[model samples]
Structure formats: structure tokens, C-alpha cells
Target chain A: MFGKVVIYGVGLIGGSFALALKHKHLVREVVGVGRNPHAIARALQLGIIDSMASTPEEAMRDADLVLIAAPVAQTESILAAILPHLEPQTVVTDAGSTKSDVVAAARAALGAHVAQFVPGHPIAGREKNGPEAAIPDLYVGKKAVLTPLPENAEHHVERVAQAWAACGAIIHQLSPQEHDRVFAAVSHLPHLLAYALVDDIAHKPHADLLFQYAASGFRDFTRIAGSSPEMWRDISLANQEALLGELDAYLAQLTTLRGLLAARDGAALNSVYANAQQARQRWIEAIEAAEAPPPPPQETSE
Target chain B: MFGKVVIYGVGLIGGSFALALKHKHLVREVVGVGRNPHAIARALQLGIIDSMASTPEEAMRDADLVLIAAPVAQTESILAAILPHLEPQTVVTDAGSTKSDVVAAARAALGAHVAQFVPGHPIAGREKNGPEAAIPDLYVGKKAVLTPLPENAEHHVERVAQAWAACGAIIHQLSPQEHDRVFAAVSHLPHLLAYALVDDIAHKPHADLLFQYAASGFRDFTRIAGSSPEMWRDISLANQEALLGELDAYLAQLTTLRGLLAARDGAALNSVYANAQQARQRWIEAIEAAEAPPPPPQETSE
Candidate 1:
């Protein structure tokens, strides 16, 4: 709970966070700060925020919380712009996909105030972006990862965690490095591969025919490729080292498969497929078990 | 449209076709032929077929149409077994993923009766298999590709098309070589990549952590990897050459991306993602347009 919450870059993630805070009455007033007047106006009309401020200085003047929800590449500039205006007690946090760069940026920009910054990434979104796409329950039932810096104060981390919990997000903690590596393998790499695969087919001579015959499997596999290109492009570059490591690992696996295919090793191929299939089944089962409601309280007999 | 429709290998595709045919009143009788007595019994009990026959010989004795919906690797043997029992006028077609090998098998097994066979690859299915997973509308609004041989009569091809049309499938005609190449790029190659990606993560040191953080994007992207391993294994080997070519092309694209990433060429990466995003949008629009119903008739000034 806070008196005034300032949300910078009021797009999908920022607007959604503002809406969640407003819905839960966790903040007395939600103030949106962004360069795009049109988006800020839309957020106001959508009731995602109580009001709009043209500058971070105006928005964070008396704010109890400041959420930097801009693109990862812009985190440094946003922090630099807003740090001078923030109150000493204002807890600063971010909703960036990549963490290391943001942590580095906080160190460079916040100086002594780095203790107020808590790095966070909520693993939830859709292909659509913008304030109009924001939903009140976007973070509900989703995992919100917190990668706090060594300089972050315990109170700042606790406040951020409490806010996300109020939004119905299950929280997980990881070191910045571990967080980057895990996300690079599971999220960033899949996005890059999907984009590459779609572009490969698009460049083919028979692209029209190829796409016409592509069924639901192809559609589902490439759905992420339809996400905001600019955002993903920034993420790919910001987390370059970890992403490249993942890409290499994935390529190595593919190479092994290529060799097996060339050698016509059906048994080996079957083994690989079976292993992947069983692993996916296990994951599905785990997720289903977690989601399944507790057996109606056991209905103990009197 | 037929006196007796015999469906060999009464699993997902075969069972669905039988149910669709019966639903459309396209056949006087539906007979199932499968080695699995339990599955055949389930098919009969579910009304996916009117009756059950223990062997291909018994099922094809008076069959007017026969649909072989087994795995691609089994196509040759199934043809060899069924040819001796098929009535002279029987118009046989298959629902295998690969076309060239099935055509080859038909030529080798049918000998003089090869003209009765039509090589087809229905572009439809789900991760689930077996008769229990079958549904009447499985092929509705889906593509069913027909690749007829030079030895085949036009009437046989026409019959297959009509049957699929009755099941609400739109039919496309392509040469066997073209069919295999297109599907290799669109379907087979994607499945292999998904399987390889999943297995790569499963083999990693931090596999549990990686999978725990893996979100909807990874789930959708790898959904096809959960498919029947034996069936996909057979398809991979059956359509080896085209798939290998595709894998090479895909790898070449990835190599280019790796270079751009290493060089930190943000503009180039953004361009690739933007191009893919736009192309995917166009494909989505095309599909939506095709699937959209005709506009309501305008009211004239009466």
C-alpha cells in the first residue's frame, strides 16, 4: 500500500500494474509519466491511472513508489531522469525482462540511492502492447521474479514483494546472473528462434505455398514471433551474452540431431523425441497439479 | 458416396474420417481394420465405425473405398497386405504425412492395381492419438492434399476428393515431390526443431529451473514435441532428404543471426524481427479472411 505511485512509460506492463494497484486500493493515487501524451490520455480514460504527469519530476515529486516500466534499453535514461525528483523513502522498482543491464544502470544512475531500487520482471504479457491492451488482472496467477541488487535495502525489497503479492502474483527470488541465464534459455531464445524460423520461411521462394499449408502446430510455434519487434530487438541486445550462450546450446543440439538424421538412426531419434515428450508431460502434470483446486476441503464427516 | 468404407488403422485420423463419413451419410457402412482389438472395439462402440473386422483381408473384401491412416513407415507393408484383398473397383487413399514414400510403396505393392491408389496427406491432427481422441469435425475447414500418380485413374482421384469434401475438408492437389518439400519446410522441420529445443533444455544442468521458469511461449512452441515419438520418428526418416535440406536452410539462417548478435548489430536484428512480424501478420490476415463468412446481404430500398 502507498500514498502516491508514479508509473513511467505507461504501456502494457506499466498500465497493467497501475490498474492492478488501483483495483486493489493499494495506492491512493496512480500517476502516469510518459512522453506519449496520447498513451497517457488513453490510460487516464481507461482508469488505469488517476491522472497523468508530463514529466517524471512532476510525477515523482511526492511519490511513495516509482515503477520504471520502460523498455530495458531505456532503464538507464529513465532512472537518470527520475532519480533527482524521487523522495528519499520512495521505493524504486522496474518491470524489465532483462535484469543485469538494469542493475548496472541503477548503479550508474542512482549512485547512493541504488539502495532504493529493486529489479523485478513479471513473466506475463500478450502479443499486443499499449495502454489499451492493459488488464487489471494481468499479473494474477503469474510468476513475478525479483532480482534485487546487493545494495537494495531490505525494506525496499519487502515493499516491492508486498505490492506484487497484492496483485495476486506468485513471487520468486533469484540472483541477477541466474535470472538472466534462466530467462535467456526459456524465453529470449525461444522468441529469437521463432522469429528466425518465420523469417526463414518468409524468405523462401515458395513462401506463400509453404505458409498456406502451415497448420495449427506452425501457428502456435510462431505465435511469439508476432510480438512487438522493437521490444524483442532491445531484449536480444541487452541480454546478448546469455542469449548467445543459449543460442549456441540450441544449435549444438540441432547439430546432433542433424547427424543422427543423416546417419538414419531412427532409434536415436526416437529416444530423443521420447525424452522430450516425457519431460513435457512431467511439466504439464506439475502445472496442472499446482492449478488444481484443493480437493474441496476433504468434507470431514461429523 | 460409397457402399462400404473400410478404414485400416483406426486411430485418430482413421476414426475421425469414419465418424465424419457416417455423420455426412457419405457411406452405407463403415468397417474398421486394426491390429489393436481394444482400439477397434472402442471405435465400434463410439460409432466411429459401423462394424469391426479383424484383418485387412476381411475388411477390404467388399470395400468400395479404403483409407489407410497408419504411420508413414508402415505404408508399404499395409499396402502389401491390403492389395491382395482389395476389390478391383476400390479407391484407396492414405492419410500419411509423407507422400513420396507412400507413392513409392503403392507402386511397389499394388503392381497392376496401383491405379486404384491415391496418395494423400491430410494436413490435420493433434498431439493426442488413438480412437478416443477422434472427433467428427477434425477435418472440417482443414486441408487434405492429394498427390495422384501417373498410373492412377481420374475417377479414383475424384472419389477421394469427394469423400474429403463430404468431411468438410478443402482439397489441394500437388505433385508428390512438391508436397514433400512444402511440408518439410512448414511441418516436419518445425516439429524436429521443437523436439530438439525441448531435449536440449531437458539435458541442461539447470533443467528443472529452466522448465519451471518456462512460460506459455515455450509451452506453445514445444506443444508438437509431445506428439507420438514413434510416428514422428517414422516421418523424420521417411522424409529425410527434404527435411535435411530444410534443416540446413534453417541452420544457415541461425548462423546469420548469430553473426549479427555477436556483432551487436541491433538494426539488422530488428529488421529480421520486423520482417517476420509483418509477414506473420499478413498470413494471419489471409487465414482470417478465408475463414470469415460472407458479409450479410445489404437491404435494398424496397
Candidate 2:
């Protein structure tokens, strides 16, 4: 648990982190730092943090941990800006979707102290924005991916893991490159596809009628399309290589499906659907099983 | 208003239609039919219909209107089986997803009486099944597409339109083929994609880890994938041609996107996302505006 945590960029993730810390009695003081004066005021009014600091340096002065939660594009610059004021023992970390660039920036800015930094990504957010949307239970039962905690100290990694555990997050460790590639397939590329589909639908001449006929299926598939463009633009850029790779794979699969459909190949379509059906069934089962409590151990002769 | 209507297959749509008819004082008698004896008993217990019949023919014996609300694949056979008992004056219509096939089936089954059979598709259904999922407002603000009416009695088409209106649906007319093509793009292909994606994820060796990291975005996008597989399978087969065309178009677009991503063309990616953003924004705006009340008409006293 973090005794004193300073959260940078009091947006959705950062604000949620403050609440989760409070829920677990994990932190004594929660201070927020952000560029927007109004957002800082609102976060204070909403009681998301105990206090506000005018600058990142001011916020991290005596903090045991510093969590830089900001737009991916701004993460490196913020890390560089805040490095000079960090305490030698303070564990610096970030909650950014993309990690490679941020890790490189942290190493450059903090030098030897770079070993204290842990790059993490929490897979949770809503289309709605601001501190108001932050819920203490947002991170509960969610996965938090930590990329390559430096070999500097076991205590540092343990402390970071404990912070995530307090918020009810299951921690998974991977290299920064692995983290990027995996998320590109699961998250970033899907978001890009949703955005593109929505745009295509909008530009159609029969847009109004088409949307009117769009069922809950279309609405749900395109909900992420309603997300902030600026944030996604940065993410799509930061993880370009992996995202492109994923996009190619998905397109190749889509093309095969199209071919089957075009030929009116019922047998082929059925095979594809059956494969998908079995896959989804397994996922659904896995999710349901995870929600249930663990089974008691079987009795055995000693 | 229908003085007495017989609803065949008293499931979600049929049960909801019973409620709507009662609410609008459109029907004096609402007889329900189901092949299953238990389902008939259950419909009666739920007060979704005034009485229950064992077969579609028996239900329509004395009814002014006969509504076929069964699955799309069963539409033709059900029509064929009921044709012998139909009254010449009765206004028979269907509420299936694919209009052309059902319309063709009606023509084949009922011969000249097919003119009384208006092929329609209602754009309403939850991820739920059965009468218990039935709600009076199920079709409220949803679209009900009626294919071009056959050269028959004008009053028959008017009767069909009124039925949908009473159920709180906005009526739109299109050719049977047009309805199938449009819905193939907006509904069928989207569902296919969702099922495939969820299936693919399920098959991954690290599926549990992937699912644990699944957020609300993925859950929403894949909700339709949780739909009744048999039902979706039937729809996929019924609208094979148009659905295939849509699949091809969608694949082509995805291929182009993949190419741009592979090339690491930031500008192209940015443009794609920008278009998607603008399209979705306009769609939301249009939908909102439609849901709002119309402005008062100006009077010219010249």
C-alpha cells in the first residue's frame, strides 16, 4: 500500500486511482497535479484527492510514490519535467497505455533513479470523461499489466504490485514490447476499427435511415467511437508498429470471410461461425468460472 | 385498428404486440398460437394473449388479422402449412428479418392470397428470448420496414401499417430486396464480425488472461455474439447473398486500412480516424435530433 501517493493528470484513471486508494486505506495523503485549473478545482470539489498541487514537482516533493497518469504523448515530457524534484527513494511509475517511449524517457530523465520507475497499464475506462466518472470500484477485478520493473530492487517491484493489489487489480508482468504488441491486437486496433466504421457509416448518403435502423448491436460495437479523438490519435501513433501488424492480421481474416460470403458458401460460412461459436462459448465459460468462488479441495488419505 | 388479431408464435414480438394492441384499443380479441403446449399455457398465464391455440390455422380461424412472428427460416413452411385454412379477407403479414425470402415463400405457399401477405421486418429485439423478455415499449421509436406491397387491396397495406403504428413503430417502405441488402450491412454482417472476433479471442491459448483484461468496450462490442446461435445461423443463411456483398465491401475497407497501417502512414491513419470520428459525431447528432420534438411551423398571414 502507498503511504503517500501523488497522482499526475487527475482525469479518469488518475481520479479513479485516488478513490481506489481511499477504499483500501492504502494511502495517507492523495495529491493531484494537472494542467487544467478548472479540472483541478473540480477534482478537489469532488473529493477525489485530499489536496491539489500547482506543479508535478510540488506534488511529488515528499511522496513515496508518483503515478503519472496522462495522455500517452505527454507522458514522457511530464516524466522529464518532474524528475528533478523526485526524492531518491521515491518509486516513480506511470499508468499509460503505451510504455516503450515512456520508459525510455524515464531512463533519460532520472538516469540511475530510472530503476525506481515501473511502467503499468490498467485496462479500464469509460467513454464518459472527468473525475465525476471515476468510481472507486473501477479497477476491481481488472487486469493491470506491468512492463519490466527494473532489476534495481525487489522492494520497489513489490511496492508497486502491492499498490495495484490494494485496488483489487491482478498484476501481469511483461516486457514493454510484448505489452505493446498484445494491446495493439486487443485494444488499440479495435478502437481504430470502430472509429473507421462509424466514419464510413456517417458519410453514406442514406446515413440517417441507416443509423435509424442500426440496432443495439451497432450501437454497442461503435460505442468506443464516441471516445476522445485526441487521446486515441496519440495512442494509435505511439503503438504504430504493433497496431499495424494487428490490423494486417485482422484484415487477412476478414478477407477470407468475405470470400466465403461472396461465393454463398454456406458450408464454409457455417464452419467459420461454428469455430467462432466454440471460441466465444469458451470465453464466456471462462468469465463465468472466474466469477465463482474457488472449489474446496478434495479429501484424500494422508 | 385490428378488431381481432391472431398472433402466431407467441414469443417476444407476439407477446409485445398483444400488449400494444391492448394499449391502443386496436384489438378486441388477441388469440395466441404456439407449437409448444407449455409455451401456449405460459403465454396465457402471463396474460399476453386472451386465449391460446395449438396451431397457426386454428388461431386465425376467426381473426381479422393473422401475424406470423416465428423465426425467419420457419416463415415459409409455416405459411405453407397455414395457407389451406386462411380466409380470403384476412390481412396476413410477417415480422421477419429478411423480406424477400419470406415474401417469396408466401407467394409460393398461398398463391393469389400472397397479395394479402405483406412482407415486413421490424428492427427490434433484445439479446433476450421468450415472452418473459416481452415489453410493451419494445418497438417504441424503432423502425418497421415494410416491403413494397403486392398489387392487392390498399386497405390491406393500410391495416399492416396501422398495426405497426399501434405498436409504436415508425413505418418505412422499401422493396423486399432493398430491405435485405440494407439490413445485411447494418445488422447481419456486424453480428457475424462480433461472433468471429469473440470466437477468435476464445481460441487463444492465453484466453483467460485476455478475457480478464477485457473491458466494457469489448463486452459491449461482443454482446450480440451472445445471441442465440441457431437463430443467427438461420438469418445468416437466409440473407446469404446480400450479407456476402456487405462482407466483401467491409473486408475491402479493412484491407485498405491494414495497408495504411502496414506502411506506417500516420497521415492516412489520422485521416481514417478523423473520418470515423466525424461520421460517428454526425450520426449521434442526427439520432438525437430525430428523438427530439419537431419545431412549431411558422404561419404566413399574407
Q: How would you encode candidate 1's per-residue C-alpha lDDT over B1-302 as one tens digit per residue? A: 78999888889999999989888887899998887889989988899888988677788887899999988888888889987787888989999999998888888988989889999988899889999999999999999999999988998899999999988999999999999999999899999999998999999988999999999889999999989999999999999999999999999999999999999999999999999999999999999999999899999999
- For the predicted complex of model 1, DockQ is 0.90
- lDDT of each residue in A8-97, candidate 2, tens digit only: 888889999889998778789999888888888899998888899877667778889888887877876777777778787798778888
lDDT of each: 0.91, 0.79
Say which candidate scores most in DockQ. 1
| Strongest candidate by TM-score | 1
* Runs off by more than 4 Å, candidate 1: A299-302, B298-302
TM-score of each: 0.97, 0.86
Highest-scoring model, lDDT: 1
DockQ of each: 0.90, 0.45
Give model 1's docking category. Answer: high
**Lowest-sum lDDT 10-residue window in model 1 chain A:** A291-300
